[model samples]
Target: MTDYYGILGVDRDTSFDEIKKVYRKLAREFHPDVNPDPKASDKFKEITTAYEILSDPEKRQRYDLGGDPFSQFSGGQNFGFGDIMDAFFGGGGGNRGPRARMRAGQDALIRVELDLAEACFGAERELNLETAVACEKCSGSGCAPGTKPNVCAICKGRGETQQVTRSIIGQVMTSRPCAACQGYGSVISDACNECAGDGRVRSRKSIPIKIPAGVETGNRIQMSGAGEVGPGGGPAGDIYVEIVELPHDFLVRDGNDLHISIVIPMTSAALGTKVSVETLDGSREVAIKSGFISGETIILKDLGMNKLRGHGRGNLIVHVEVTTPNKLNKEQEELLKSLAKSRGESQDDVEIHHRGGAHSSGFFGRFRDAFNR
Candidate 1:
């Protein structure tokens, strides 16, 4: 008195195709290999039994008429193997034609070293690499001159062999790729000597690579159709070029911004002066304001790295370090003392203040803010 329709979550009037579709979904969900629940195995068995009995038109009709269909066989009855194969594997349990020898190739990757200037600005390079290419001797056909492939006699160009065997589920039909043909349906008896029937050969060749600006270390550039050729001279795969940026002599890069430190005389910082610094664009003079403290920054617009996949450029942040006269001569010391006295400062006069607290708007403040920035 098993209600197969109720077990499959379908009404009695449901069509066989609808029943099979539901069974496929339930099977994928409850199959032991996929579902971890212990009860799912028994649930899968119940659903599979429900589908097998309900899928057949005669079984469905007999069950509808209140007759027992399982009474005739002590073991399981016969069902077409294609039904199970199709339900589980998305169809194609029947005869399949030969597979093509040519297929898309795999992607390849390589790393290249670049200098700061080269990375900041786009550049082209010609590099040599060993990769697979169409064989010149065989013209990518894999056959020698004036010779061609022959149809496989074992599978008769079908590329597969089928057999039926009795199992717990009754007769089951199975098919596999033919060993003789290797699924190609044809055999290259007279293969090209240079390529050894693969239709391609490995050789060293030079290819040009164009690197975009602002590419950082570990950034990859993809070149389509620049990889290894396929087995039978099919379309080549893509080539990925990974960048390794070399350290610059003076400039430190952070994203698109560039950083450089420059030392200036204390007098120049106090009195204000323009100092020429070397930038990627060329030598540029940066103006220091009067009373400018050490550790302050000067930003030069459009002087950093060129923007990658974008417009314009970044800024060059110049860090200033004022060099105090450590060993002042007698005249210089006297002059500094006189200037300090004129500015109301003396040897014994002292003012104690915490950094970045109440009084933090002068030389030390600017210096701390510079480093913090």
Candidate 2:
């Protein structure tokens, strides 16, 4: 009889967490991949067997009472960490039952472009998509009518097979997944022709998605359970609809604020005029006051993009660009000369601005005097 506690290098009253920590350290050192020495393999197996027996409370009690616990391991009942490691380390691993065919589907992503108006005002868009859906013929069973999968004869439903081979130490037993069943333990002899035993088919679908206001480019809208249908009719994954906002003709967006530039003649800037400005709502009038500057802006409240999460909309900014009148007639040129002469700027290099009987000077002073009106 082997002393399980002595093999694990732990006391009889050692905590399970402490025991697990010690066992993991020894496993790392004595694992065949880490240690080239032939004796390390046997030592690793001994410690693993001891750890398995001691980890289970009932099995440890039986071993403490001088009862055989090896019977339990031989029956291949308890599947633990050590048992799983054997499959990867070329040892005769414990029997692993058939793997299920059904699994959760994978998430999918698709990008859709939206009109600027559509993004400002929420709109419904029908998406044409191609995704995997459960096959209709066999209801995701992957079998034809009146027939089902049969147990694999090679591994006898165990999903793996053990083989003994000669090594330097002696006969070393190794286990591998059965080739015929591919670890599924069952062969679909009468596979469904539609999905070809995958239980899902590639099909086109039309899904309607609502485009929320204020959703800009690169924003993703997640639709739960709208992605690919998992193999064997498992639950569908989420579908992410990414937004790509289309460019507006005249308006450029900065956050929630919409900006547009309009050019007006210098006469319109001198004399007050009204202009038609297009907003998210519709065309609105923006008054350009007399002597409106070239780089001035007129903001319309609550006329921009709607807020995605909060109340109220953003502002629409109208950028004004005053253009000088070109191709003036003789009468217009004579009238402008008469107006300039009357203002006393026709002969002087720059009209001096007087402050308390003193002439203001310098570049900044000249600039201030030029636009003082």
Candidate 3:
């Protein structure tokens, strides 16, 4: 296998932060998005994979023990270090060459939409997923029970072969895996029919997932070891459950706070009234003060969504909008006119005048004044 340090173009003594910095720089330079060259893209992927493994302590430990992290390791199934090296770098030949089988398929993502109540209160979901599972016929092995695979004679079990290339200065050296044996240094003569000489098959599975309370949109619930079965009878990867919160009919969310707009009649704004507010739990009576103005907010403490990773709930802000009566009956109009007459004396014309100011007239002057203010 390529040295993680070498792949990252850093020294073995480099710190974790230094390693990350170097990886980011190299990734930016060689990323497929920035560099269209196929070779650069492949190299970028290789380096990124190497950095991902090395930066993680658990994966790095496994790699240090000569283990192929991408392959399955449980149940005595193992991958040769040579095969890992050949898989990343081409098997010492011009051809892509045979590669070792991998285990623990890969993690998958699925989106689930939940209402605000469900996101706050939590719920159980039954997921129908189609993934690769181990074959039952040969017990995860490609060979039948009685017979086993034979050693490959092409690469002599080394899984790779050396090549000599002519260069201007001298002979160049390269290595690749033997095509016949596929880097396993062995071939299954009587392969199992169930898995078609591989070790896994596609099957449908139903799993129950309990979404935790206080989960928000874009939050992921990881189901450990629930992913696809690895190649060659390896362990399974994890499955990530992505949450997508549905929009509520009456409320909009901000962090954990719930904002709602409530419409009240003009009479209700003048005369205090108790309103029945709907909530996830049930309904509650909220009192509106007399002489309430439009665009005013009433805060209901601890009535919002629960904190995703903390204790206590957020406040619910209710914005009030007073609806004015557009069409008034004769009696209503007469009563309003009487009320206005009692408030003050009526006048025919009222003249308003503005004192002269530097920006009171011109457009640009007003614009500049607006910005300065």
Cα misplacement distance, residue 86 of candidate 3 (Å): 16
Q: What tens-digit string does per-residue lDDT give for candidate 3 at 57-111?
A: 6667787788875543231122111122223333355544444454446778989
TM values, all candidates: 0.64, 0.63, 0.66
Q: Candidates ranked by TM-score, best first?
A: 3, 1, 2
* Per-residue lDDT of model 2, residues 220-304, tens digit only: 9986557777776544677789999998888777788887778899989999899999887899999999999776678899898
Task: Give a tens-digit lDDT track for model 1, residues 51-73.
Answer: 76788677678788999856433
Task: Extract clashing residue pairs from model 1.
Answer: none
Candidate achieving the largest lDDT: 1
Which residue pairs collide, candidate 2? none
Locate the minimum summed-lDDT window of 10 residues in model 2. 75-84
Candidate 3's C-alpha lDDT? 0.69
- Report the number of clashing residue pairs per model: 0, 0, 12
The true-versus-predicted C-alpha distance at residue 206 of model 1, in Å, is 1.5
